[model samples]
Target chain A: MHGECCFESEVLAAVVECRWPERVESELRVHASGCAICADVALLAVALREDREVLKSIAAPPESGRVWWMAQLRARREAEKAASRPITAAQVFGAAATAWFAGACFGASSDWFRSEFVRLASGAESAGIGVFLTSGVGLLLLLAAVSIIILVPAAVWLAVGKD
Target chain B: MFRDATLRDAIAAALAPADSESGSLVESQDVRADFAMDEDSFRSFYDRTARGLWAYLARVTGDRQAADDLLQDAFYRFLRAGTEYESEAHRRNSLYRIATNLARDARRRSVVRPDAVVSGEDIERVAGADSAGSLDLNADVERAMSRLRPNERAMLWLAYAEGEPHVEIADRLGLKVGSLKPLLFRARRKLAGLLRGKDSDHAR
Candidate 1:
């Protein structure tokens, strides 16, 4: 009986690890035929095997698209938030250029600037320097507006896309 | 013998009364019609196995969020692989193979970050009444899983948890069945050692 108990324990370990050999199975059957104690141990091992299989079925993870989708949405939001933080040096440079153009446009309309502009324009034969300044300022303003239109969308798209 | 007869009858009845109007039935029919028809077969297979797949993923990753992402990615790749399955086992084996690869990829991508923290709520949902008692067990399992090479963990889990035959495991994992025995033994020993440690800690 003691030997049977020991053998049964070893079988339990082997079976649990899925290493039970064909010889072990034959030995177990032989032991079970002669000894009731071994038979009981064999039954217990079988029960444990059955229980493990049942536990496996019970432990299986649930599948819900809703849960998975929520996870994906959370990951995507994190990626976007990470992407949206402080602008890089390139972006800062772009923003600085836009701000300078706006400042230049405002400066162009100033009275002191206008008087200096008229004096400079008087040197040019047909059209004053004011015409040159006005056209130049207009072109800068148009360039800034076009940049704002193109860049904001591009930045937003870059931030949200790819992931 | 009687039970086997009953089961066979039950299966036949289940398959016999298929509704033509049902989308799942239509999909199943489409899959059965063509060996080369990959999309419908994959979709049907995913629908059937997603829960089991997620369970395996959650157990492996120990993080519900990571498992969720990995599960979707795994299914996406399975659809793309477009392999014709000869049997139900083949289909399932393919799914697990894809999932294993996805988990490995995710692990490589985020080596520095801590694995997803499994919340108490997640534990309750997965472990149910044994949630409190199994916490240590779950932690031990996860730790053991982390110690294993990704493929080893994948092999051990599919073999033990899924009860896959060695041949199927070999087919799915692309390893010789004989080569897997020693590796599987080592993995199990590692897990058993971890569990023993956890048990001792609880005793203390």
Candidate 2:
């Protein structure tokens, strides 16, 4: 739309630069009619414009509504899927933390029991039987501790995952 | 339904090509403000733009199936981006940018596969004529398009097929406006030569 040599610039931009036009402007047509250089530009632009229409005509895509519906459904599903991942991660972390807390508590309680048993056994006149009992009890506590540490969190995590 | 129609009108106006010299930045801002956070709004927007976008994807990738998958991915990423744009053109450009990047990444992940065999019924449908000649020509055009590098194909399609201005095409393709001209020139010349060679082969 610029006057003088800017017409050539515009024509060049339209013809060689972008090689497309949504619509040919009358001003450009007028200028091209007057200028030989722009005349060739105009011809090329017109041919390209025709080619654009031909390409468009050849392209018959699937229905817009159908594509849109599929996109909507996909977006919803993806959002839902993305929302679930963080929750799953948090659940796993929560399960592990809970297991560690439970183990610590079980270990502390076992220590208390062992200390009490030792205290009582040390103060006993017949400490051999008491020491044997303490050893037996300590073994049972260790087994209980191992079982709780291994089984409880596995059960909790799986149950949470199912939900 | 009335409210939905009103929303659709608003979005359409927002996305309509800029009319004023200053561009539709202000109008688009107003439209973005009204962008409904519901599926219905997004669906309406999709209805307005999907076919052209899908056709562009199909043209660029030369695989209808990849187009289908990429179309969904493009829209999904657009919705997730949640960007406020200066104009409808800007939003559309952003969508194309996303689509271009996705297409490029997908192409990098896997080599271009051979074209699927076109069933007679499908070819007939595409040709809309009984002439097998037109079907062959259409297939040839697609094959020729596939031979171009992905970015070259995109630039050519955006320039000649989509009628996008250099500035918009540059924006979508992440190229400088000044650089688009020479690139487009080369692409157009190559395409013209391919078409000419195809015509000559048919003459023989």
Clashing pairs in 2: none
lDDT tens digits, residues A1-163, model 2? Answer: 2223457557646654443344457677576667744553444344443333333444455444444444444444354455567767777777777778876877778778678567556746465545544576655755676877777767676747654
- lDDT of model 1 at residue B98? 81
lDDT of 2 by residue, B118-159 (tens): 335564344335346555655655666767877887887777
Scanning candidate 2 chain A in windows of ten residues, the lowest lDDT window is: A46-55
The runs of at least 3 residues in candidate 1 whose Cα sits more than 4 Å from the true structure, single-residue gaps closed, are A1-128, A133-163, B1-44, B111-119, B122-136, B200-204
Worst-scoring 10-residue span by lDDT in model 1 chain B: B20-29
Q: What lDDT does candidate 1 reach at residue B196?
A: 52
Candidate 2 docking classification: incorrect
- Residue pairs with backbone overlap in model 1: A61-B55, A121-A128, A121-A129
